[model samples]
Target: MNSVVTRRNLLKLGLIAGTSLIAPRLFAQAHTNTQEIFITNLHTGETDRVLFYDQGYYLADGLDRLAWLLRDHRRNEVGGMDPKLYHLLFSLQQRYGQQKPIQIISGYRSQATNQWLQKNSDGVAKVSQHTFGQAVDFRIPKVDTQELFDVCCSYRQGGVGRYLSSRFVHIDTAGVRHWG
Candidate 1:
């Protein structure tokens, strides 16, 4: 047996095993269809349609477009959004099966913006996931927001909040919790 050949085979198996450890979702995934989402950033009044994931893989350009869209608008600062956040959005969109854009009230927030929001807003958290680019507050047009909140909660994905007055559902990757 050639030692080099054996080493090559082991390296291949190791790669396979390492890939196994990545992309394990907290929930069961049925990613058979192309994952696409239409988005509208309310603050920036910008819109983008992204085919973020397809064939069991997340596309980088699509994610980049998403992160760009999710940037803090107050100071025009961009942040690297956590990809898990996209997977959650994809799953939610899949469940709704709607073709309409996800109307975003909030996404990535700079610490300065967050601090300002905390001072001015009633429920803004000091350590919000938005600062970490791990959360989104959004609503679909013509969709019942209460029902959307219920749908977000049903997934058991992470922190889910229904702000009725604001008419948006907030989801985040930091905590497994639900709130109003």
Candidate 2:
């Protein structure tokens, strides 16, 4: 005797098959537990690797800008970024899945730069995250801006501010919430 298959069972079988087919490729290229990034202090002429680990990334001395910027006596204030920020950035990078490095428009901001931004842009927050070395402004040249924002939003690690108007996203570890 032939048995009749239920519609629900067929749908379930199809979904399982589809997932099984796609799962391997996804797992093969899954996000690495750690990611390595090279950062250049254009002002200070220094270079360092920013390593992103599971919980967050580590900011090395070379990555820190206070020493470099202080040497040049520039009005730029540089400090090690919060680890949460790095993790957030890493997650965003993973979504892109491209080896293309991220371009930082601005990372740590000195009081002078903050003042300049305040005067220049109406959108600049008076009490910005830069004051505490918690904010990062960056862009991935070859990646889609909207796609980047969407990925960042997914993590909800901290504060993911999408600045489509300015074409750079602002990421911070601030517990406070603000996004555009």
Instruction: Please tell me which predicted candidate would have the highest lDDT against the true structure.
Output: 1
Cα error, residue 112 of model 1, in Å, equals: 0.8
Instruction: Enumerate residue pairs that collide in model 1.
Output: none
State each model's C-alpha RMSD to the native: 7.1, 8.6
**lDDT, candidate 1, 1-180, per-residue tens:** 799999999999999887777645422256645777888899889988898878778889998899889999998898888887777777766666657788888899999999999999899999999999999999988788899988888878789999998789999988689999
Measured with C-alpha atoms, the lDDT of residue 110 in candidate 2 is: 70
- State the lDDT at 9 in candidate 1: 97
lDDT of each: 0.85, 0.62
Error of 2 at 105 (Å): 0.9
| lDDT over C-alpha atoms for residue 51 of model 1 | 85
The sequence of per-residue lDDT tens digits that candidate 2 reaches over residues 41-141 is 44445545555443233335424432332222246444555656665666666666546556666666677777788998777778877766787777776
Highest TM-score model number? 1
